[model samples]
Every structure is written in structure tokens, then in C-alpha cells.
Target: MRSNLLPILTALGLLSLSQAFAPDPEPRWWKGNTHTHTLWSDGNALPEYAVTWYKDRGYHFLALTDHNILQESETWFPVATAGGARLQPDQVKAVLESKNPLLEERTREGQREVRLNRHTELVQRFSEPGKFLLVPGEEVTSSWRSPGPEGRGHPVHINAIGLEAFIPPARGTSVVDVLNQVFDAIAAQEKSQGSSVFGHLNHPNFGWGVSWEDMARIRAGIFFEVFNGHTGTADAGNENHPGTDEMWDRANILRLTELKLPLLRGISTDDTHHYHGGKVAGPGRGWIVVRAKSLDLDSLTQAMRAGDFYSSSGVDLQDLKVTPTSYSLQAKVREGEALTIEFVGARKGDAPEPVVFSTSQGAEASYTFQGDELFVRARVTSNLPHPAPKVEGETQRAWTQPVLPGR
Candidate 1:
């Protein structure tokens, strides 16, 4: 009877087809961090404490991408008065304060051990519908050593976001080979899961490990970290190496013009390790704001792959609109803060270096497409100093995804 009434209402034009079924919710910007660690791996803090930190700071989602491990197994940590069990005093304090019932107190031969909560438990404790989310992920950490007297090696770390199972690091002869292997594995997982899973290359310049040319040669990965908050990585390259931004531009130029692969999108991540003190690799340093219908895993990952996100160290974008004919941006700024928006891109000719097409002052800027450009992207810089600057003399900055001429 209800089905017949719906058809009769449609026939009488009381309800249009568009109105008969609910449309998707309007997409909104959700703040999230893709790479962070806890005691599930080498990080100093407990899993619940990390979630509490981000949630309290208004982060919509957090991915705990521990090194080659998922938070699915049972684990325990020693309650240390001194620094023992690879646990610091502050870490123990944070864990005990949470009062998680899963924590088992046992006298293990001499030391007191407390069972740690698994990822499932963490999800049940913190995740709220459309408010905060915990995404399960893994850092497929791998390395390769060059065959020489010095035996120098490179760290190849790739992050797999929104995965249900663990994936071991894929190996190969060279850096490019290893990267391609990891991307292939990620693809296989996506195919098998029938869900959108996100993957990105992490910190290309950490060990001066991946060169711009190496990045351009990869067959698959479409995302990489343009800015990582960790101080260990050389984000600003020296005389011999190029920075991550340089690598991004050069690799995109090669990929779009010559290699015939898709342009790479940039991401900013905290890569957090320490949660206490003025530690270098701490949280709240970098993140991405994704525009999606809701703050769920599927929506966030879908929006990210669609290039509907912006990465930031400190600058927050007020508005970003990209159409087939133009690119525009406006930043949300505080008083006494100055803004500079650089419209950067390359031309359609042979091996053109990325040049600033135009620059705008104040809080807003834009550029109309000339139809002769390979791609265009924006960079917003502000005078406000980063609370925890990744590099010396660094200020606040944000990067938008590159826009192709059309499609």
C-alpha cells in the first residue's frame, strides 16, 4: 500500500523523482591526520591517549599507521616507574589515567604488566557517528642498500590507509622497483576488498632516499607527502638534493608530458611519534582537510582520491574552488597575519620549469586557465610562525592539488 501511494504521489506530481529519494548530503571539510604511531609500534604513548589528543583538538579522523603491523592482536606493556619495557613514565601515566577495563594487572615474574587495548576496543571507546573516526592503517616500512663499500641504504616507507588486514613490505632491487611493488599490492587489496583504500608515499627526502627522477619513474602511486612534520626528514633539501616540492613539480611535469601517467597529488602528514614534551615528531604539526559528505572512512577516502582535499602545515583555507576554466583560493587568516597566494604551473611546451603565473596579496587569489598550461596549483603562505616549525625559519603554509586543463 505504501509503494502504491508513492507511485500515485509521483503520478500526481506531488513528489518529483529528484525529491522522492533523498539526495546525498553536501560535502563538508573534515580535518584528519594520515600518519601517526603509538605503542602498537615504536610510539611512546598508548593508543587511547593518542585518540584522546586528536579528538580533543577537533580532528575528525585519525589513522594510526604503525610500522608493518595492524592493531588486531593482544598486547601488553609494563607499568614502569623508570623507563623500562620500552615505555616511558609519561606513557604509563597516560595509560593508567584512561582507566581502560581491558588493562590487566599481572606480576610477570617481577615486573608489573598491563594489557593494552586493541584497535577494536579503541574504536568502541572513542568513535562517534559523523564526529570522530579511527582509521586502521599500516606503514609498509622497507629499505634497500646499495651494493658498494659504504653500503648506503634508503628508507622506503609507504602508508596503506583504511585496511582490515596486514600487508608485509614488498621488496625489489631498487627504490622505484620497491615503490611499484607496494602500489601493486595496494591495488590488489582495493580490488579484493571492493572498497576505496588510500595509499601514499611517505617522506621521500628522509634519507635523501628517493630522488625526483625516481619519483617520476614509478608506474603507480598517485599521492606523496609534500610536507611531513618530522624534523628528521630533510624537507628543505641541500645543495645536492631537491626538496619535496621540487620533486612534486618535476615529477608531475614528466608524468603528464612524457610518462603519460596521472599527475601526483600532494599530502601533508604529522608522522607523529612523541606525544609528550617539546619533542620534534609530535602531533598537531600537519594535516589534511578533506571535503566529503560525512566524516566516515569511505567518504573521506573517496574525497581524497577525487583530489578534493588540501594539505596544510598551519594555514587554513577559507575557500577553494576549481573549475575547468579557473583556479581560485581564499585563506582563513588571523589578525596581524599577512598572506601571499602564488599561482604556480608549467606550460605545454618541452620541459618547462614551473613558474609563478601570478601572485596575489591579502586573503584571496585566483587565476583563469589559459588553455596552454599543463597544470596549475596554488600555494598559500602566511607570516604566522609555525608552533612547532619543521625547519628553521619556517612559517605557515598550505598546498592545493594541481588542476589539469580539463578533467
Candidate 2:
């Protein structure tokens, strides 16, 4: 019996040795939405109510990025109607219906009003050890009129996730100056507070605002929303402008090849403002799955900083494997649905537009990085319609973070 088992032991030893040298990922994937709103600025619902929505929906982390302000200060907002503009009464009504008990409401000078919940209260209430978390965030809503040839008042709105304080938008003669100001302010915060946070450019094509060249030139603007659920924001390209995917490729090529800078990471966000009805700007439309050790702000932000996350509109990836030589993904598919995994990347010299290097059907797909390939990333698409699709004929999709050459 001992002689017969000797060969099996040798084979087992070889298998163990090979695995020790192979790529092994240890962090767990924690789901979260870094862009969202509460009634502190433009969102309709109370912070408590909005947080409850995400927590109930199984979100592991969330950042309530109200425009131009943080929820840290105590303030009261009068009940206002949407008027097809910003916050509407209907959103407040939805909050009232929740019977949250924490909704602080009172009549100020005979005006119906609700006091915004403090971010501190939320961290105390919702933050669980390994279950759920609240990330402090703010939307730096800055804009500047382009020198023509570009669009109108180009919104340089940036979303800062888990920052220590509010970052006001910086305006400049050009897009680059404004962006630099915002990033510099964030850097200052990190240095002074000894804290960490991440920033992402919001809706690059909202008004044909940011030029493709501008996207490439803003080197410190390390992240941007590739897919935003706002209806007015054009996700697809028109006759003149490139679509989000097209813009991403163009900017990245310039950054990685010419600028010799770090590649920009892509994020999908709900940017939910109108919470009521089946409106376009609502939650559950988009979010990110972060590979991290715990559901804490530091852990998630660190993982995101490392580009150890993927954005999804509806699809959830069970496993994502990225190594120096290859990249791969696996999805938990529903019955009767189909998946098409496309390996999208480019080659060296006169960096060609990203094309599908490989394609496959079913749940799992992978792409081996050829020596010539500049970078390789997987786009997993399923036949299932996006839960909160902005346009018709939209299917659920997941974009793995790009794996660059030899890294």
C-alpha cells in the first residue's frame, strides 16, 4: 500500500508547489456606492432615509456626496419643491413615509422644514464591524465657461469620497487649472489630517463639457465615472463627441503612452437624485464592488486607490483574477440569461483604439496579455436588462479594472 501511494504524494507535492507561485487574492469583495445624495444639498430624502435604503439593499458601503457641502455641520433646510430643478417636495414626502423616527422636522418661521442629519450620527448608527459602512463624501460643484469651441458652462463637478472635510470646486481660466486646484485641496487635507480619501470626476460629457484632451491632461484626476445613471448626461457618443467608453480609451492611451502617467480607473455610479418613481436618477442603477479586508472607509478607499475594484450597473462578479500575464472574471449568472466576455485592450506604437482581443459565451472568460498588448481588461455583459437603465435596450455589464503591461 505504501509503495502504491508514493506516486500520489509526489503529484500532490508538485501541485502545492505550483499553487504557491500562482496568483492568489486574499481580500473579499465589498459592494458600495461612492456617489449618492441626501437632502443636505440636492437629494430629496433625509440622510437617515437614504442610508436606510442602501443598507436595506445589501450595500456594504456608501458615500453620501451632497453637492458643495458636507453633512458634518448642523443645518436646517426648508421644504422645497423640485420645480423640475433640484430637490422636490415629493422626495421629502418619500422620506416622511419611511417613518424613520430620526427625521428631524419642525416649523421654522412657519416654513415647513427638515434638519439634515449629521454625518457623525450616521457613522454611529449604520457603521457595522464587517457588515455595512458610511463613507463621508462631498461633491465639489465647480464650473467655468469654456473659451468656445468647447461647450457652455462646463461643469467641473468632482466627487470626493471619504474626505475629512468639504472640497470646494476650483475655477480657472482653463479646465486644467480648476482640476489642479481641486486635487491640490484634497492633497492638503490628506497631509493636514493624516487621513485618506479618493476623488473622481463626475459626468465628463454632461454638457460636452470636458474635452477628450482635457480628460487625458488632468493627470492627477485619477478616476472618472465611465457610466453615470443621470438621464441628461450622455453615456453614448454623438456626431461630434466620443462616448464614455471611447473617451476612456482615448484619454488612457494619452496618459499611459504619451504622458507616461498612471492609468485612470473607471467607476460607475447611480448619482441618484430623484429617488421617487421610476425616474432616471435613482439608486440601484450603478455601484462598485471593492476588494478589501473590511467594510471600513480606510480599507475600501485603499482598495480603490490600488484599483482593486470593478464597477457594475447590474451584474455582480463572483471572482476577478488579474496577474502580470493575464486577467480573468467569473459571474454568477441567472437562468436563461447569456454572457459575452470581451477582452478589450490595445497594442504598442501609435496606440490603436481598444478592440475586442477575445470573446466568449457563458459565465467565465480570460485574456492572456500578449507581449505586444499595452493593457488588457474584461467587459462582462449579460442579457439581463440593467435594473435602472437610463435608456432602452441596456444590458447588465461589469468592467474589470485594467491590467497594464507587466504589472
Candidate 3:
């Protein structure tokens, strides 16, 4: 009788995937930072300390993406090292304060070394069912250069999120080739594991490495850093070069009109390495707020893939809605904080530059699509300065994913 009623309920429009057996679910926005470094790589803090930092600060999830290494193995680092990345005196105090039982010490070469907490250990210590989560990830660090006198070297880094194991850097003949190779490897891993794994292109202008043309040419890129908190990332362009924002727009235009590929969404990441204050790279600079059903890896990544997320430096968004006919969002701000919402996108013609479709000023804004756009995205800005500015004169901002009209 129950099986016979299922088709009748479905035909009556009462049964669906989300409401077939239970009431429709309400999704919540989860804050997370996808890029971070710790003692597992060149970061100047312990893994436990880093996890504590985010958890205590109300971050829902974090990915400790060390360079080419996952925090899965038993590794040890000397408390005080001569050079390279080492924990400071204060960080050591915090590490000890946690009283992690996994903490162990040993004597090697007449110097005492402390065991670096593994990812599993951090999960056991830090992960709360609904409060906080530690997502396993790695930064697939790789580089390439042209072969000649004028051959400039470029660092091509990609962040792989939700990894069960380390992904070796896939080398290729050129920059585009390298991006494609790494993307393919990520896909292969997702296939092998039979789970959700996401990849994003790191800072493109780190070494002036990836050009906008290279970004436009990539066929498999899902996302790229439009705003990175680390110094020397070059999010803003100089007199000669285009910034990452412009690069994103241009790449999207080309991908939508010429390359016939999916437009890459923008991501904001801390890429934080410095734990102590006073350094350029630190936590709380940038992150993504994702709308998902639950605070888990698969749900978050799925929402991110579906573009149900926004990247923010300091500004927060509420009631964000993206539909076929319209795109709208409301800014969550403090007292007297001014807001500006710009609908920026490219049209369907041959004009290359992206223009502002509409601009709204105040706490909330919405724009109705005329259905002739290649893609339209929102850029929300607040007059309040970033508490932890990535660069001088940086203001609080949030960016929504681009919507392709008539797609």
C-alpha cells in the first residue's frame, strides 16, 4: 500500500527528493576557509593551534592545506628551530595548553622535537558535530617556467579540498598544461575515492605566473582566487598588468563566448601562514560562506559547486537569492556602515569589457535580469575598513557567483 501511494503522491506534486519522507529542509550558511598552512608545511604554528584558532573564532570549517603534504602521518618538529618555519614561544604555550595526549617528544641530534598532531588527532580533538569541522585538504604546490633567456618562472599552486590522500603535482609542458594536468588529477582522485573532491586555482599573480589568457584557456578550472589575504599575491593590478578581478571577468567572457567552457567562479582564501600578528599573512582575512543543508564536507562542497556560496573579506550576506529572472542579496553590517552593490557582467556581443549593469546603495539590493547577459555577478562593498586588511586601503567586501542568463 505504501509503495502504491508513492507514485500517487509524486503525481500529486506532494512527494520529492527533499520532502518524500520528511519535511523540506532548511539550509544554513556555514563559514569556512579553504586555504591555510600549519607546521605540516611552512606555517609557523602547530596543527592543533591552527584548528583552535578557527574553532574559537566561530569558523564553521577549515582546511589545513599544507604544501604538497597532508597532515596524516606521524611527523615531528623541533620546538625551536634555527631557520625555516618553526613554532614560536607563545605557540608552544598554546599547544601545551590544549593538553593533547597525542603530544610526544623525542631527542634527535641533541635537540628536542615535538610530535606534530596528525589530521585524525585534530579531528578527534577539535571536531564538534554541528559547531566546527576540520576538512582534510592539500595545496598541490608546483611550478614551471619557459625555456629560454626570457623564460620567466611561475609558481602554479592549486588547492585540493576533501582529499583522503596527497596528490602529487602533475607537471606539464606549459602553464595551461599544468592547470589542466592538476585538474585532471583531481578528477581522477574523485573517481577513485567515489566521493566529492573540489579543486581551485591559487593566486594567479603570485609570481605573475598565470596570465588572464591562461585562465581563459583552461577547460576544467572550477574556481580561482579572486582575493587572497597573503601579501604579494597581486589581487590588484599595477600600471601594466590586469588585476585578478579583471582577469576573472575577462576569463569568464572568453569561456562563455569563445571557449564554450563553464565560467570559473571566484574564491577568497586566507592562505594564511603566519599565526602571530604583525605578519602580512594571517587568519581572518578572507573566507567563503556556503549555504548547505549540513556542516559536512560533502554538503559544503556540493553547495560550492552549485555556486550557493559567496566569498567575503569582512562583509556578511543574508537572504541571498539567485534566480533565472533576478539576483539579490542583503548586507549584514554594523551601525553606520555604508554599502554598495554593483551588478557587474559581460553582454552577449563582441564588446570585451565587463560593465556595471546596475548599482544599488544601502543595506539591501537586487537586480532583475533582462536575459541578454553572458553572465552577471554581484560585488558588495562596505565603507568600513577591513579589521585585518590584506592590503593598504582594503575595505570589507563580498562577491556572489556569476549567473549565466538563459543558460
Candidate 4:
């Protein structure tokens, strides 16, 4: 009996040693664009071509977030206006050439001319294992009244990532009601599928329509675009409503500290529609670099859910850490330009009223939270080209991972 017990104990000790020696999981960075359009809806480039554009540009992941459609079924348009919106002459030629083989087969059977791959098919074809990935997504394009009674509907775009199918736009009597409906739909999807499908209010300042009140009352909204790459979407500047970044901080301060709602974070995206003949069609204007355990969709979404990403127009951060005690960030700069980092936060008793603490620029910086501070967030900027520039004025801006209340 003693001999048998001794052998069992030795085996157990060996098992424990094996477990201890196993390697820790590796950390990875996945660069992704959450909002994008393709020929399936209003975008100018074909889905296949757009996929190539991102994959070729070193983007590890992309989402084809067309408006209100999932690129599932096949559709067609006239040869002259095959893909809606504007198309450069070369874009037209590239599309037609790619479809020439299919056209020849159709011609032999006395059928009509020209066809392109369905958006889903194109994405599936282009996506490869561990190299590049295409995650299914969509923008629930809706509208709201600006001011006047029966005010003209202003466009409001919302990106839904990791969705299984298309979500129809919420039809309602008011913008607030519409937003609530959309939010509810997203929540339902998350509950039913047990999948990570994050939804964000896109570009509140795009039309100067969405307000602090609008964001304050949103119950299910977890994120809103702090920056968007497109014409007329204001990320900076002090015009009435706060800049998207300021709005994020003020809203979080009020909601979490004052109103006791869950805190929300900022997201940056290239809400790209034009893909031909302009600066808007260019890529790398805005993106989010997410730190995840793996490059898969689940891991990426998990990180996003935890606010483990930074929005960027340019500027990459070397390290970012957020904890209950303090918030810190560091930026890696380009050769010629200097870098600056700012730690921004609001205390619980610091008056729901907004205030700017410091506006100095430097290579590195930190802010101490005093009194009843609700949470803290940071922004890092550099003299680099805007990663996604829809217009001339918007330039490079980098935002750090948000550190929320109650750790």
C-alpha cells in the first residue's frame, strides 16, 4: 500500500510541474476598421477590391459595414451605374475587367453582360486564416429632426460589429425613440446569439444633431465614435457642443458619477463611403488598435468590450495602462515630430459642469485624480498626417484606452 501511494503522489507532482511550465498566452495587436462601405450599398468600390485595399495596406482585420445591408444576397445595377455613388474611370475598368470571364461565359449562352461577386462572397474569398480577416458588420443608417417642427431628417450612422445578419433601421416618431429602438435591437442580438456584437453611435457631431442630452439618456449604448474619417464629421474644434472627445468625458462624468449609469468609451472609425477620386477614398485615416489575446473575432470583441483599444488618426502608443489607483499612457512619435500625452478625468464632486484641466503638449504626461473623481481618459497627439482624412483640416490625433469608474 505504501509503495502504491508513493507512485500516485509522484505522478501528481509531475502533473503540477507540467502545468507550471506551460507557456503563457501571447499578446497580439489587431488593426481594424469598424465602419466601411462597399458596392453592395452606397460605396463606390466593389467588395473584393475594397477587401484587397485593406488587406494590402497591412490591416489585419476589416468590417464591411454597409448601410442596412449585410451583402448576403446577389444584386445588380446598370452597366453605366453598376455600383451606386461615384466611380473613377479606372475603378469602372477594374470592375469590368474582373467580371470579363463571367461575361464571356454569359455571352456564349446569349445572356446579358457584366456581373460582380456578391459582397459576402467577395469577403469570404479574400479572407484567409491568421493573415487577414473580414468580420461581418453593418451601419444602421437612420435620421433625426434637427430643430424645427417636422425638421428635416439628419443622417445618423451607427456601426454594428460581429453581427450575424442585417438589422433594419429603427422607424420611430423621434430620434431619441429611434436610437432607443436600435439600441434595444442590438441588445437583443447580443443576448440571443451569445456573440460579441458591439454597437456605437457614429459621429454625433457629423451634422451637429446628437447632443449631450441625447448621449446621457442612452441606456444600452456602450460606445460612440469620438472620431470619424469623412467629410463634415467634426472631431475637434469648439463650436457650441463639445468636440467628440470632450463630449465623451463630460458625458461619462455626468452619467457615471452624477446619474449612475454605466460609463461608455470612445471609438474611432473611417466612415468611408467614397472610394474613388478624392482624399475621402483614401485609407488609414482613422482606426483602432486593439490589444487582444488572439487575433480571432471573439478575442478582438472581448477586448473592445473591456475598452482595451485606442482610437487613432495617426500616432501609435508604446504602452497604455489603466487601473483604479492611476491612469497612464505613452506615445511613440515619428522621427521629426514631438509627441504629447494628456491624462483627463472628472471627479464625482467636480461638478457635472465641464472644465479643462491642462492643455500643455509634451512627450509624456500624467494627471492625478483628486477628490471624488468618477473616471479618467486620455488623448495623445503628434505632428503626423491624419491617418484617415476626409477633408483638409482634420489632422493627426490619438486617443488612449479609457479608464472607467469603480476600476
Candidate 5:
């Protein structure tokens, strides 16, 4: 028996050694938020409250992207109104109670509120090995105060994800010039820090600030929020600019088929500003489910860079795969609810044209990219009731992972 045991143990040891040397398998479905706000800016919740809200809600990661500021110094004032909205007294006190002791001491002379977490502290509390993570981020809130009558200042908010420090608002004379400055700043950050930071144009249709032509011209970053969860951001139905969904399709078609740039993908984010029960930007409205090998920042960012994720409003897809033979999608519906999947794509000759396809009402569907199609993208809509509707009395939508041609 001892002799037999010796051989078995030896075999087990060899197997373990080989397994250690083998490459890791791909990961599936890491839930996270790439956009969020805290008390540092206009958010009503404390940094700790926001972190705990996501962590408790089973999110694998989060990015505390306050507007134009990193969680550095303590900030406070009388709970006054800005943009015609005031913080609820109870909400303000709740945040003030959670302030860090050191922060309280530093601002003790005339402080009304204290910081809950610095940028480093937030990251530390939420980030965990292969389980939970947090990345440092900031929303560069820039707007062009147009001089004409009906002189609505065009609001352009861009999120700088995975940044090491705060980037002050880079205002410009024009909207185009502002975006250029942003891209230039991101480029500089990349060169200096050796970090994997990416920028995305947020809420392009918010006040009709960014146009499709603008998106076509700026080729620096390959990401934008096609779906934002704030009020009046205009995710759908515009005269000149297409809906966010349509904008995504058009942008990809133009980039790949027309300009021959890399296929730019869309991200869905809860650009949450109101945290404590109000009718503004709230959580769980729209989110991205990334498929990566781990929850680490590098793995998550790499998967996003490779476009290995699907944006969702309310629908959930069981599986989304883009293969050599075909593009496939499988969705799970809410109990007793029906589901439909669509396979949309375009060909090389079909430049500047849209690809639209839909499946029969069922749980699964597939589309074959036969012959020379320039690209393929897909979307799924479910009969299940969405918690938040895009418009009144509208059904929910889930976008599939895009399948690029000849990749």
C-alpha cells in the first residue's frame, strides 16, 4: 500500500506543477460601475456610503467619479441650492456623521462637514483580490457658455477612468476645442504615469452638446456612454442627432466602414448624482457586465479595451459570443416573460448603411455573417418589466457584444 501511495502522490505533484504553468481561463461577468458621484462634488451620499451601497448590492467593482475633483481635501458649506436643487437636511446630516476623524480635526476651526474618504481610502476599502475592486476616476465637467440668444451653455462631461490624480477642468473656447484639450490631457497622463487610463464622452445628447460629427472626428478614445441614467440627458428621440442607441450603430458603421478606425463600442452607465431617493440620476438603471479573467483593474480594463462586454438597461443575457462562424446570443427572461434577440450587422459594400435584424420571440437566437460583411452587432429586448423605462410605457433593451468583421 505504501509503494502504491508513493506513485499516486508523485503523479499528483506533477499534475499540480503543470497546472501552475498552464494559462488561465477567461473570466465571465464582472458587474461594476465606471461612473458614480460622491459628496466631494454634488452627490448627496458620503464616499463610504456610496462604496458600501455598491459593494452590498453585489457589484464587483466601482469608480468614484466625482466632477472635476478627486477625493482629496474636506469640503463643506451651508446646505444651499445649486441648479435649483437643495440637499435634504437628513441626507446632509447622514453624510456629516460618517466623516473621518482626521479630516474633522483638520477642518475643526469652521467646518460644517468633513470628508468621509480620500481617494486612496475609498480604493482601499472596496478593492479586494479577485473579488471586489475600485478604481480612481473623475468626471471632467466642461461646458461651453455659448454667447447667442437661447444661449444655453453646452454641457460636456467626460469621465477620466483609472486616473492617478485629479485633472482640473480643461475649458475651451468651443466644444470641439474642449474635447481636443481633454484628449491631449489624457495622452499626457498616459505618457507620464504609465497607467491604463481611458476617457469616454458622457451624455453626448445632454443639451445637444456633442454631435455625431464630433464623435467621428475625435479618434483618441474608443468609448462613450451610449446610455446614461440621468434625467433629461436625451438617450432617445432627437431631430438632428440620433438617439443614443442609433448613435452607437451609426458611429460604429462610420468608424469601421467609412474612416476605417477601430470599432468604437458603447457603454451603459448609471451617471448617478442623486443617491438618497429622488427623481434624478439613480443607481441600477443601466450598467455594463464585463467578461474578463479577473476582477483586477488590469484585467477589467483590458477586457473593456477589447470590447468584451455588453451594455444593458434592464435585460440580462445568459451568454453572448462572437465567433468565426456566427454571432450568438442567449438570454434569460424574467419568470413567465417572453424574450427576443436581434442580430444586426453591416457589410463592406454597405458603408454608411444600418444593419437591423430580429429574432422570433424566444429565449435564444443566432446570426451567421456569411460572405464579406464589414461588421456585425446585436441587441436583445425582453418582455419583462424594466424598473426604469427609457420613455413612458416602453419595453426594456439589452445590447449584445458587437462582432467586428475580419478581426
Candidate 6:
């Protein structure tokens, strides 16, 4: 009924929201990092360091998602404990040596260090009109011990993007149990606050945690990390575990076929911790290009939930178009680099729906739906290697969002 009503509303020039699947006001792609960390958790740098790192590298937006913690209050952390007092020797050295303006030196309780700015304060300072933004978020690092040493268990991290409040990780014995609770908390927060929020399951292959079956059953888990930049978090699957790409296809197939759920959207992020060096799993390693009405947080999040974005690691999209049945895309190709655009999706009776529909060796590519397929999406691969490769032959790539039956 909702699908049938869209054409009527669009024709009558009434409110045509999702049925329209229309682009936002003056739509343009805004680049951002959705999963990230700072000194708030196990990250090695300050929150502002992460924020500025992305902004300087041409990102339009950012979400500082530290584990189970939001940057809400003023707190001082010891960087290099010495002289029996709190100290940030590395941060101080960097600040003084480089003379970065964002760094603030302060004396608190007879300890000298760089002052860590709260999320509220940094948002005010970093937000620029139509240029940069910081979307407040937190990573709910859930755990379910299933036989690891010291009771330390496999990790199930979910990032609640555009969150208005903090959500503690849901604890359970099964990964699916924890995932459902985390998603419910995100939903409940939006319900109570009268605001909007969207979240995605973090790297499935990280620590060899989360499987195709683990993600397939969670009706609320509509997004996951198809690509992550952190080297420790393996994106590719081995013989024993399903790689992120495999998990993505399998989960989508089971969800769309058996459960009749919504299509899962793919996202990428640096998951960066080290900020001082170029070789680290740092900012600019991965990002999402979101086509939205504006560069503000609200518009970006709205576009993201609607899958109006593509994940990329060092690949830039030149243009994209989608109808109910087909998708067209063009990638920005660098000189001396070869490009291959592959269309992938699931057909009837396939456990995983992704079968290659077309392969083009150029900057532009397109694919029309065969109509019998569950959904169709595209992946653009380039011969250009990453400036810092996570694994061997980890060339540059971009993932377009899936196009479903009516969208």
C-alpha cells in the first residue's frame, strides 16, 4: 500500500517522502567518518585531534565514537605518567613542536597537560557553515564470552551515529542477543528524545567476531561495516571465518528472502586510533560520500538512513543515479590507474544473492535489474593501491548502496 501510494502522491504534488525515493535539496556528496575513537577510550589521541584530522583531510562531517563513552564532560587523562603526576608528554611535545592551535596546555591539580575538550565545546568550535561538522555518537562495545581467556570475549561493537545520549552496550551470551538490545536502545533513545538516529554494526571480522548467521537474524541490524581501515580489524575473510563482503551478501540474502527485511546498507570508516603519523590506521583511510540537502548533521543522517551514500576507501564517485530497476555510477579515475565497475546482486535460490551482472573497465558503469533479482549494487575497483594498505593487494574501492525492488 505504501509503495502504491507513492506514485499518486508524487503525481498529485503532495508529500512524497520515501515513496518518492527522491534526492534531498540541492543534493551533493558530503564525506565523513562514522566509526572513530580518541583518548576517551583506547584511542591514542584527543577528541579534537580526531575531529581536526578529518576536517583537514577534506572530510565534510565526522562522528567521534569512543567505546561506551561520549565526550560530554571535561576530563583530564594522563598521556605519559611521570614525576608522580598526570602528564601528556607526547601530546605536549606534539603541541609545542608543531604549534597546533587546537592544542591547549593547562595546569589541573598540579598536573600539566593538553586539555581535552568536551563534545559540546568542540562542536561549537569545529562546525563551519557548509564546510565541516561533527555528529555526536558512541560505540557500544558489547561482549559475549564463549570461551576466551580471562573471560575476555569476542567483541560486538555497534556504533549509534547521531546519538543524543549515551547507551551502554547490551550484554548477553549470544552475539545476536547483544545486537538486538543495542539497536533497541538506539531506537528507544530516539523515541524518548523526539530526535532521529541511525546506527550500524561495526567490523564483523574484527577479532574474528560476528558471522553471516549472527547478523542475518537481527531485524533491526540494517547496516554493517563492509570495509574498515584499521589493520587489526580484518575486512577480508579467511578459510575459517566469513569475510565482511561475504557476510554482507549472505546476511542480505537470508534477510531479504526468509525474513523479508529491509536491504542492508554498507558503511566504511577509519576506526582510527593513531593520529600523529601518516602510516597508522588513521583518518582518510575510509569514509562515506553522502548526498544530502546540506552539510549539517541532520541532513547527513537523514540521507544515510535512506542509503543515499556510498562507502569508499581512497575512491571518489563522480556521479550516481538510481531508479526502481537500475543504477548508474561514475568513479573519479586517477591517471595511470585502471578501473573496473562490477554489478553484483542475488538471484532466486542463491544462498547469497550477489552474482555479477556486468563488469565495465572505465570510469562509468550501469546495470538494469533483471527483475527477478532480490536487489542490485555496484563495486568500483581500481588498480591504484592504498597509500597505506591494510592487506596485500588492498587496492582502492568504492561500494554503492543497494537498489531494491521499488527504490
By TM-score: ranked, best first? 1, 3, 2, 6, 5, 4
Error in Å for residue 244 of model 2: 1.0
Query: What are the candidates' C-alpha RMSDs?
Result: 3.4, 8.0, 4.3, 5.0, 5.1, 6.8
Best by TM-score: 1
* Residue pairs in collision within model 3: none
Displacement of residue 333 (Cα, Å) in model 1 is 0.7
Ranking by lDDT: 3, 1, 6, 2, 5, 4
lDDT string, candidate 4, 281-368, tens digits: 4556788988887777888888887888888888777777765666667777677876666666665564655554445576666665
Q: How many backbone clashes does every candidate have?
A: 0, 1, 0, 5, 1, 4
Report clash pairs, candidate 5: 347-374
Record all residue pairs in model 6 with backbone atoms less than 3 Å apart, i.e. clashing. 237-243, 345-353, 345-354, 346-353
**TM-score computed on alpha carbons, candidate 5:** 0.85
Model 3 alpha-carbon drift over 4 Å, by segment: 1-24, 81-85, 99-101, 388-391
lDDT of the structure predicted as candidate 3:
0.86
Off by over 4 Å in 1: 1-22, 83-86, 99-102
Task: Please report the candidate that would top lDDT against the real structure.
Answer: 3
lDDT of 1 by residue, 283-355 (tens): 9989999999998888887878778999999999988999888899889989899999998878888668977
TM-scores for all candidates? 0.93, 0.87, 0.92, 0.84, 0.85, 0.87
- Looking at candidate 3, what is the lDDT of residue 45? 79
In terms of TM-score, which candidate is stronger, 1 or 3? 1
lDDT of 1 at 314: 93
Instruction: Write one digit per residue (lDDT tens) for candidate 3, span 1-407.
Output: 36678878888887874466775468999999999999899888788888888988999999999999989787878777644446655567666777554567788988878889888888988899888999889999989888999997889899998889789986789999998888888888888998888899999999898998898886655799998989768888767778888889999988878888887899999998988876578998999999999899889888988889999988899779987788889988789899999999888886767889999898789888897788999999999998766467989899999988655
Q: Model 5 misses residue 323 by how many Å?
A: 1.2
- Better model by lDDT: candidate 3 vs candidate 5: 3
Report how far residue 253 has shifted in candidate 6, in Å.
0.4
Q: What TM-score quantifies how close candidate 1 is to the native fold?
A: 0.93
Clashes of 1: 0
